[model samples]
Target: TILGLWSLASMSFGVFMGRYVNTEYMQSYWRIRAAGSGLSGVDAAASEVASLGDEAAIISFTEGTIVDDRRTIGYVAKGTIYCVAPVMRRAMPSAPVEFWAAGVGCCERRSNFDCGSARLPGGSLTALTYTAEGDKYFAEAVKEAASVYSITVGKRAQRVFFEGDPAVFIDDLWREAVVAAILAAVFHFCTCIIVSTALQKAGVRWVGGARGLLPGDELAAEDMLLRGGAARGKDKSSTHDHLRNVLDPRASWVEEKPERSCLGCGPRHYWVFHSLEEQHVEEIEKQIWFSESRTLDQGCDPSFFDRVVIAEDGGFNEVATLMKSINWYRYFSAFLTVGMIVYNICYILKSDAHMITSDDAGGHMYLISETVIKPPLDFVLRMLHIEGTGRFNANVVVPIMEIACLLLVLVWVTVLAVEAALVEPRSRRRWKNLSRVLFNFPPAIAGFSSMSLLHYVNPSVLIEHIVEYSHRRASLEPVLAWTKFVVLRLLCLVIGVDAFLMKFRMTAQYINQEDIDMRCVCQLAGFILQLIGIVPVSIIVRERLLRAFFGGEDASEDIEEKAKEMTYHALLCREMYRHSQSDLDFVVMVLSFNDVDFQGLMLNMNSSKMGPRTSLEVKGNAQVTKKNSVEGRKSLEEDLENDFLEVARAASISKARRGARPGATTRKPREGRAGGGSPPSPICP
Candidate 1:
C-alpha cells in the first residue's frame, strides 16, 4: 500500500513541476542577469529602462540567428530581440503597429517557452508571444494582478521593455504544488479502497479451531469423516453406528478425542483430519461438526479473533505489497521520458517554430540525435549496428521485438473484441475475454511508445484469483502474478544499462546537460519518496516472498510457513463453502464451479509437506499431545491391514499418543514429538 502511494506521489509532483518550469525560463534569466551586472545591478536599472515598438529589437546574438535542432540549414537568421511589455489586442495609435501586431499567430499557447519569472522594467509590463518571428512582438493591454518581463543583457546588446500591467505569473508555483499534494492524497485513498475488497474476501478464515466457521459447517465435516470409513473396509452400517456412538454429546463413554486429525490450518485441532491425503467430503464434514461441537462444550475462547494479526491477517495488504514492487519498473520507465522532455525544453529555450540559427540548420533530426532513430528505419541499406549519432536510439532488434509483441497483442485484442461483441458472457469467457486485461494494455503500450510516465496499475490476476476464484486463471493473470517481481527486476537492469549509455553519449555530444537536470529533479523526488514509502513496502514484499518460498534457516519453520498456505486452501474448500461467502466459495467460483480440478491440485500441494506431527513439533504450542478417548475404539487400529493407504490414514494418529503409535505400521522415530511418540512414516522405507 505504501508503495502504491509512493508511485502516485512521485508522478504527481514530477508532472506538476515539469508543467510549471522549463528551459525557456532559464534562458531568459541567464540573459537578464548578464545585462544587470553592466548597469551595476538589475534591481534599480532594469525597472528604469523601457522600450516601445521597434525600439524593443536589438542587434542579433550570433547575428540574430537561433538554431533549429542545432543544425545550420534548419532555419535562417534573426536578431536577438527582447520584448518586455504587456499583451494587448492591437497596436497603439502612436507607436508602430508592425512590431505590436503579431498577425494572430498567438493565443493561449502552451509550451516550455511560455513559462518565465522575469518582471518587466521599472513600471508593470510583461512580454507577450512573438508572431512569425522573434523580432515581432505583441503587447496585449492588461491591468494588475501579476507581471513578467524578458530582460536580456548580452555583452553589447541592450534591454528593451514596453510599459503596462501584466499580472498572470504571480504565485503560480504555489498553485501547482498544492494540486500535486491533493492528487497524491486522492491516489492513496483510491488504492486503499480498491485493494480492500480483495482483502476482505481472502481473510484468515482458515486458522483451525472454531474461528470464522458457521454452525452448519461442523455437521458437514462430521459427515465427510463417516464416508471415509469405507476406505478402511468396514461395513457402512456398522461404521455409521460406531461413528454415531463415539460422536454423541451425552454418551459418557464417548471419546473426547476426534476420530480424525490431519495436517491442517492451525495447531492439531481434533476435528480437522490429520491424514496425509485429502479425505472424502463425509470425513471433512464430520471433522467440522465434531470440532464445532467440542469447541462449544469446552467453551473455547471467543477472543481468539480479537488480535489484529489473527483477524485481519493474510489478505489484501500481503498480496498488494508484493504487487507494489512493480512500481520500481514504472519509476525507471518514467525516468526515460526525461530525455524527450529536456529536448522539448531546449527547443523552447533556443527558438520557436518560425526561425533558427544558420550554424544549426540543415540537420535531419531533432535534438541532434539523427543517427539515433533514423538509420535502421531507412529500409534502403541494412545495418546491424548503429555506430554514429544513431547509437543513442534503440538498435534494430528492439523495434523488431516490439513489433512482434504488438502484433500478438493486436490479434488477441481483435479476437477478444469479436468474442465480446458477438457472443454471450459465458461463451466469450470460454475463449479468454480481454475486458480487464486489454483495458489497461492500450494505455500501457502507448506509454511504452512515447516514453510517458505511466502510473496506471492494478492488483494482479493471481491476487484476484486468491481473492475471488476461477477455474482457469484469467488469460494473463498467472503471467502477471507469478512474474510481478521478475519484471521489476528486469526493468531495473535495463534502465541501469540504458542510463549508462545515455550519460556517456550525452556528455560527449554536449546535449545531455538539460536532460541531466530533468533526470536529477525527477530522481531527487523519487529517492525521497522511496525513503518515506517504497522502502518499507519493499521490505514487506521481500519478507513475504522469503517466508513463502525459502523457509527460514530452521527446518520446522519450513513446515510452519507451508502450513499457512495449506490451511488457507483447506478453509477455502470446506464442504459448506457456498453458504457463508467463504474461502472455498471464492475458489469454486474462480474455478467456475470446479470446471478445473483445483481440489486435487490443492490437496497434493497442501499435504505434500511433512507437516508437524506432534503438538511439541508445532510452533507456539507449549504442551504435549493430550487425547481423552473413547475406551472401546482405543484399540481399533490393531485390526487394520496396515497397507499404504491405511498407513497414511493411520499416520494422523501416530503422532497423537504412544498408544496409537504401537499399532501404526512403518513409523519413524521422530525425536521431538510429544509424549516421546514416533511420527508415522507414510511411505515404506
Candidate 2:
C-alpha cells in the first residue's frame, strides 16, 4: 500500500515539478542582461526588481575605488566560489569602501581580487548576484566572505554576482525524474495486466469475492442438472415391456454424437442418455453413484478420464541443467552490480576525490576525502604543472547519473529474482503493484548521458569555468575521466542484464508473443544504442587504461575479449538453446497435468535434474496436491443429498422405545438366530 501511494506520489510530483522547476526557478535565475546598465543604477531600482524578475538587467558596474586588502573568497556547500571586494564609491581618501562587490571565480585567494577591470578604473562589475530574493544560502556565502575580510557589506551589495553565467551548466533534473516516473508507471501497468490475466485463466478470480467455485465445477453441475431434467421429462413404460422392446430386433439404432468436454472433465469413452429401460437406468445410477464417490474420495477435479499416454523414455533434464547454469550467471551478474555500487561509493567518498564545487568563485573546490591521494592519471599529469592551464573541468553531474543507473539495475535485478521465486497469488499480486514503480533504465540513462555529453563538449561559460576549476585541482581530471569510463561500462552491463531477463521471460512464458516481441525490439534497440554509444567508447577507454597502466603485449586481444564479455552477447548466445529447452520442459509439464500419476512421475523424474531455482516448480506441484487434500475435507452437507445420520438416529430411537414398552410381545429367535435387536446403519451416497 505504501509502495502504491509512493508510485502515485512520485508520478504526480514529477509531472508537477518538471515544469515548475524549469519555468519558475531556472528562468528566474538565468536571463539576458540588457547593455549599459550601471551597478549603482540597478541597485537603486531594487524596489521594482521583484516585479521585473528575470526581465530586468542586473549586469552593471559600480564606479568606485577598489580595496583589494578587504577582498575575501567564500564557498557554498556545492563548492560554488565567490569573492567579496569592498568598493568605495566616494573619491575622498577618508571614505571607507563599504560597498562590497560579489564576483564569482574572480579571486583565487582572499588577498587577490581580479573582478572585471577593477584595477583599470577602480570599478567592479556584477553580472548576477547571490542575493536573489527567496534564496538565502548564496547570500550567506557572500556574507561569510565579507566577514572574513572584516567588511560589513551593505544590504544592497550582499548579493554575489558573476561575470559568467552558471546557468549554462544547470541541467533539467526534474525532466529526467519525470521521465523515470512515467516509465515506471508503464512497466507496472503491464506487469499487473499480465499477472491478472494469468490468474483468470487459472480459474482464480483474485479481484472478485468468489473463491471456492471453479469454472469447471460450475460447468459440471450444469451438465448434471440438464441430464436430470431430461430423465424426468421422458415417459415411463412397464419394466418388462421396455426390456422386450429393447430386446426386439426391429428397435431403431441412433448414432451418438461427440460432445466437447468441459474444464477438468477430461475425456469420456461411453455416453449415457435419459431415455433408457428401468433396469438400464438402475444399473447406470449405481455406476454413476460409485464413480462420484470414488472421484470425491480421490479429490480429483476430473469426473471421467481416458487412457493415459506414457511419455517417450527420453531425458528432459537438459533445460533443468541449463536453467541452473543461468541462475549461477544471474547471481554472478548481481554480484557484479553490488561490486559496482561499492566501488562507485568508494570513489565518490574517497579522500582527495576532486569535486568542482563552485563554478565561478575563483574556481573554489572541495576534497571529498581529507587526505590527498591522487589517482595515477593525475599523478602523471602533475609534472606538467597543469594547474594554471585551465584545460578540463571536474563535474559531478555524470557521476550522479551513474548512481541513478546503478540503483535502477539493482532494483530491477531484485524484482526479477522475487518474481521468479513467488508462487502464491496474493503474494505475487502485492509484488506486482510494487514492481510498477520500476522504470526502464536504458532509455533514461541514454537521455541523461546525451545531455551530459552535450554539456561536456560545448564551450560555454559554465564548461570553461569547470575546465579551469579542474585544472587547478590536480586529481579532478582523472577522477572525472574515470567516472565517465565507469558509466559507459555500467551501461554495457545493463544491456547484458536486459538480455538475460528477456531470455528468462521467454522461458517462463508469463507473457505472450506480442509482449515478448515488443520487449525484444526495445532491448535490441537499447543494445544497439549501447554498442554505438557505450561499447566502443568503453573499448577505447579500456584499451587506453590498459596501455597506460600495464603496457602488455596482449592488450588488444584482452580488450576485444573484455568488450565482447561486457556486452553479454557471448552469455546470451550460449544460453539461448537452454531457454528453448526450458520452454519445451514447461510444455511437457503442463501436458502431463491431465494425468495425475503421470504428472507425479514426470515431477519425480525431473526433480533431481533441476537446481535450486527450479524448486519453485516443484513447490507449485506440491501446493496443488495440498489443495486437493484440503478439498477432500469438505462438510458432510456438501457431499450428501440429505442428512443420513438423522435417519439412523431416528430408527435407533424408535426401536429402543418399542423394546422398552410394558407387556410387549417378544418372539425369541430360533436356535440359528442368536443376536439382539440392532439399529440399521446410515446409507450415504
Candidate 3:
C-alpha cells in the first residue's frame, strides 16, 4: 500500500517536471531560432556588399559611382546626402540647398553670391542619387546600413567564448538537483518508517502471516461479507470473487499471497508474501464487520430486531426506533458561527456611527444638505425616536459615540486575542504568541478606528461639496485647488499634533510603562490616521472638481498623467499602513510627501474652480476684429454647450448601465416578455 501510494505521488511529480522541461525547451528553441535568423540576415547583407567589388576596391567605392558587374549594375557611394525623388519633391517640399547655405554667412554670403561654394564641403560637387523601386529596396538599404555597423564584425571575441566554462552556469543547477534528490530520499525514508510503525501499531501483519487462520475463520468472514453485501473495491468483479472465496472455507488463500508482497521485494521471498496475504485478509474482515454494524444500526432488518428483542425480553416501539440521532456539537458550532456574524455586524454598524458622529459630522452635514436637504441619521433619530431639532445633535452625539465605539472595539479585539491565546494548544512557544499579538495589534486598532470613521464621513457630502465649490469658481484648474487643499491639510496636521501630545500623556499613564513610552505609539497612530484621513479627502476633492470642470476627456487625460506621479505615493501609503519596524521615520517622511502631493491636487482643483476670472484687453487691430465677431462666437459657444450637455447625459446613462451607484438594482422583465414564464407570487398578501 505504501509503495503504491508513493508510486502515485512520484508519477504526479514526474508529470509536473515533464511539463516544466517541455516549456523550457520550447522557449530555448525559439530563442536559438531567432538568433540564427538574425545572424543569417546580417550574413546575407555582408555577402551582397562584398559582391560589389574586391575587398580593397569595395572600401574605396566613394562619391556616387555605378559598379558594373558582368550580369548586373548597382550604385556604390561613400558620403551620404538627403535624397529626394521628383514625385516626393513636389508633394513633401523642402527648401532649396542654396536657401540654407545663404543663411550661413548672414547677408554677406548672399551679397557675394558664393554661399554654397564657401560654406559646403566638396563645394558644388555632384553625386548620383538613386530612388528605390519600392519600400522593399528602402528596407534592404536600411538592413545593409545596419550590418555595416555590426558590433559582431568589429569587436574581439571574449576569452570565454571558444573555451566556455560549463561549470559557470550549469554548476548551480547540478548542485540544486543533487540536493533535491538527497532531500527526496531522506523524506521518502522517513515517510516509509512512519508508515511501517503506524501499520504495526494497528495490528496489521505482512502477507505470509495468513496461514495461522483457524478452519472456520474463513467461513465466518464469508458469512459476515454475505450479510453485508459486496464490499467496495477498485474492481467490482474482484470484490465479488474475493467475497465468494471467503464464503467457501475450502477455497485456497494461497493465490492471494504473491500479489500482496512489498514492491521492493519479489513475491518469492517468504516473509514478503506472508505479510501481503495476512494484510488483505485483515482488511476484508474489518470492512465486513464495519458494514454489518452500519446495516444493523440503520435498522435494515426491522422484523429480525423485533424477534431478537422478544427472545431477549426487551421492549421495542416504532416511535423509539424512528428518532434520528443529532450531533449536538455541530448545532452548537453553527449557533456560535451565527452569533459571531451578528456580533460583527452590530459592532461594525456601531463603530461606523461613532466615527460619523465625531470628526466627520460638519463635512457630512454640509454634503447631505446639498444632495438631500435632510439626510437620515438612522441611529440618532430612528432608533432613539428623537424628532425635530434633536436630529441635528449628530455634531454633539457623534464624537462621544465614535470614542465609545473605538474603546469597545479595542476591548472586544483584546478579549478575542486573549481567548485565542488561552484556547490554543501549548505546543506553540510563548515568543511566537507574543510576536503574533504585537504584530497584529496595530491593525486591529486601526481597523476599529477606520470603521468608526466610515460611519461618520459621508462620501456623497464630500463629493457634493467639491462639485459645488468647483461651480462657484472661475479658474476651475486643478493646481490652485490643490494648494488650498494643502493649507487645509496643514491645519489638520496641527490639530493632529496637539491631539497626539495629549493622548500620548494619557496613554503613558494607562500603560504605566516608563521605559516603553506611549508617546511613540500615539505619534505613530496619529500619523497613520492623519494620512488615511487627508489622502482620501484630497483624492475625492480633486477627482470631483476635475470631473466637473474639465469634463470626462480632460479628467481622463489628467488622471493618466497623475497616475505615474501617484505610484510613489501609493508605495509610501502601503509602507505606513503596514507599519514596517525598520526606518519608521524615513517611511513617515515619504508618507508626508505623498500627503502634500494629495493636498496639492485637491487645493489646485478647488482654487481653479472657485477663483475669479481675469479678462484680458485687446490692443492690436487684429485682436479687436477677433473680439468684434461676438455674435458668431456666441452661436458657436451655444452649440458647443448643447453638445456638451448631450455628451454628459449619454455618459451618465452609460455609467448607470455599468453598475455605478443609483443603478445597482437589477430590473425584472414582464412575465409575457420573459419567455412566457409566470410572475413570482407576492409574499405580502
Candidate 4:
C-alpha cells in the first residue's frame, strides 16, 4: 500500500513539475529580453538629454555678422561659425576664428573680393567658416552656439536587469522536489503500517476461538454407533406390537398351532398330535404375554414426541445453515467495496466547464453574433461561476478544484483501507469488531473538513504561495522524475505481493475444497492479468471514466482502492497473518460454525476420540517430518514452513508441524479396515 501511494504521489509531483517547470524557460528568455529593451530606453533618454542642452553650451551666427553686435558673439563664414567665450582672455585660440580667416583669405581675396578678419574685444579674430546647403549639422551647431548649457540635471534613466537569479531558482526547485518526494515516501510508509496492523487485528478477530466449536463439542463415536440400535428397539415395543409381531420371527409358535384353533380337544388315536398342538398354543400364548408385558414397560409416551422434534430441529447442521446466512452479509459488503472502488475511478477524469477562457470564447461568440445573437455554452459557464464577467477566474477555480479532487482521492483510499481491513477473510469477527471501533475515528471527515477550511482561507494567497514555491524549487527535476519511476516500480511490486498473499490467506482459511481452489485460481488469474499490463491500464481507464462521471466524489473511491491494493501488497510481502496447516484448519472450523459453544464441542470430540497414545504419535510424527522437510527443502519448503509457523504462532497453536522428508512414507495402521479406509490428511506438502 505504501508503494502504491508513493507511486501516485510521484506521478502527481511529476505532472506538477512538468507543467510548471517548463514555463521557466520561457520566463527566463522574456526576462532577458525585457532587460535588453530597457537598455534601448536608456539610449533614448540620453538623446533627449543632449537635445535639451543639458550637457553643453550652444551659440549660433549668420554670415557677415559684425563682431561688435551682441547677437554677433560668433561669426559665420562659408556656412561655419567661430564662437568666442565671453570670459576668455588672449585670442581664444581654441575658437574656430584663425582657421576660418585663413581659408577665406586664401580662396576669396586672390580672385575678386578682399576678405578681412573681424576683431573681437577678447582678442579673438572671427571670420566666415565653410558651409553646406540643407545641412542639419549646421542648424544643430547654430542652435548650440546660441543656447546656454545647464549645469543641473533632472531624473536619471531607470535601468532594469533580469528579475531573478537562475542558479538560485534552480537550486530551490531541486530542494522542493527532494522534500516533496521524501514526504510522499514517509506518508506512504506510515499509511501502510497502519493499514497492515488493522488488517491483522481483523484476521485475529475472525478466527478467534470464542466464535468457533471446541474439540470436545463433537458427538462421541460410541454414541453415534448406538443411536440407530436404540431407536430400532424402541420401535418394536410400541402400542402396535401385535402388528409388529406379524412381521417377527418369534410369532412362529402361533403359526404352528393352526389346528388347535378349530377344536377344543383331539381324538384318542391322535392324542400325541393334539398334545403337541396344545403345547405349541401354550407357548404361543406365553410369547404373546411376554411381548405384551414388554410393550407396557416400553410404552410410547407423549414426551417422546417433544424429544424427537427437538432432536430434528437442533444439531451442527442447523448451526451450519445459520452461519451461511450470516456470511452473506460479509459477501455483500465485499461487493459494495468493489463497487465503491469502481465509482471512485470515474470521478477524477471530468473536466471543469468553468475553466474556459476568452481565447476559447472568441470564435464561438463571433459566430453567435452573426446568427442567433447568443453565446454557446453560456449557461454552462454561468453555472460554473465563470462567465468571463470577472466574478470568478479559471486560474483560481481550476487549481482549487484540482486540489479538492486530490483530497477526495486520498479520502477514498482511506475508505478502501478501512473496508479491506474490516472485510477480507482472516480473523473476521475480530476485524469486524475493530472496524466498528474504527468507524468512529472520523479521519476521512476530519481530513475533508481541514481541506475545506484551508480552501476557505484566502484561496488566492494559497495559490500564489503554491506557485511561488513550485517556481523556487524547480531544479530538482531529476529527483522528481526518479521518484516517479521508483513509485511506479513499487506499485507493481505491491500489486504482485497483495495478489499472492490474498490467494494464500484465502486458500488457507476456506473450509470448502471447491472454494479454496476457486479463490486460488481467481487470485492467480488476477496476478497474471496485472503482470500482463491489464491491471494498471484498467486502473487508469477506470480512474479517467470515474473522474469524468462523478467528479470529485469518485476521487475518494480511487484512493480507497489504491490503499486497499497497497495494504494487501504489503501484507503479502511481509508474510504477515499467514497460517500453518493446523491454524488454517482451526480458522476453517471457526468460519464453518454458528453456535458460540462450537469450540468447546470440538475440544470434547478431540479429547475423547483421539486418545493420548494416538495424539502423542501424531505429534511426534509431525515434529520429525517438519524437521526433515525444513532441512531437505532449504529454499521452497523452508520458506513455506516459516510462513506457516508464523501464522500458527500468531493463532496460538499448541504445537508446530513436524518436519518431514519429501519422499518418506507413513507406517500403516493396525486393526483398521483393509488398505486403510481413511483419506490422506489435508496438510501442506
For all candidates in order, the CA lDDT equals: 0.32, 0.38, 0.34, 0.32
Whichever of 1 and 4 has more TM-score, that candidate is: 1
lDDT per residue, candidate 3, 1-685, as tens digits? Answer: 5568867976776666555544533333333233331211111112243232222110111232111111111112343221111110122122111001111121220023221122244432211112112334333332342243221221210000000222232333344445555676677678768877765444332321333333323433343342232222224445434433332222233333233444533232111112323434554444335433333333322111211111111111211221122135434543443453344434434434544544544434222222222344444566676666325543333335445666686676567557645754432333233323333333334333322233223456546545545654425766777577545544434333433333334334445653334444544444345335433453345456435433444343255545532432333233333343344333232222223333333232233223211111111112222222445335533543454344345545655676554533323433455356654421110
Per-residue error (Å), model 3, residue 2: 4.3
Residue 231 error for model 4, in Å? 59
Misplaced by over 4 Å in model 3 are: 1-8, 11-242, 245-403, 409-685
Ranking by lDDT: 2, 3, 4, 1
Top candidate by TM-score: 2
TM-score winner between candidates 2 and 3: 2
Go through the candidates in order and give the clash count of each: 62, 19, 43, 81
TM-scores for all candidates: the values are 0.24, 0.25, 0.19, 0.15
Residue 443, candidate 3: C-alpha displacement in angstroms: 18
lDDT of each residue in 192-276, candidate 2, tens digit only: 6775565333322211112322222233224222222121211223322221232211223322222354433322111222122
Q: Sorted on TM-score, highest at the top, how do the candidates line up? A: 2, 1, 3, 4
> How many clashing residue pairs are found in candidate 2?
19
In candidate 4 the C-alpha lDDT for residue 345 amounts to 30
For model 4, give the 10-residue run with minimal summed lDDT.
267-276
Q: Predicted candidate 2: what Cα RMSD to the true structure?
A: 28.3
Off by over 4 Å in 2: 1-12, 19-25, 29-126, 131-134, 137-148, 163-685
Better of 1 and 2 by TM-score: 2
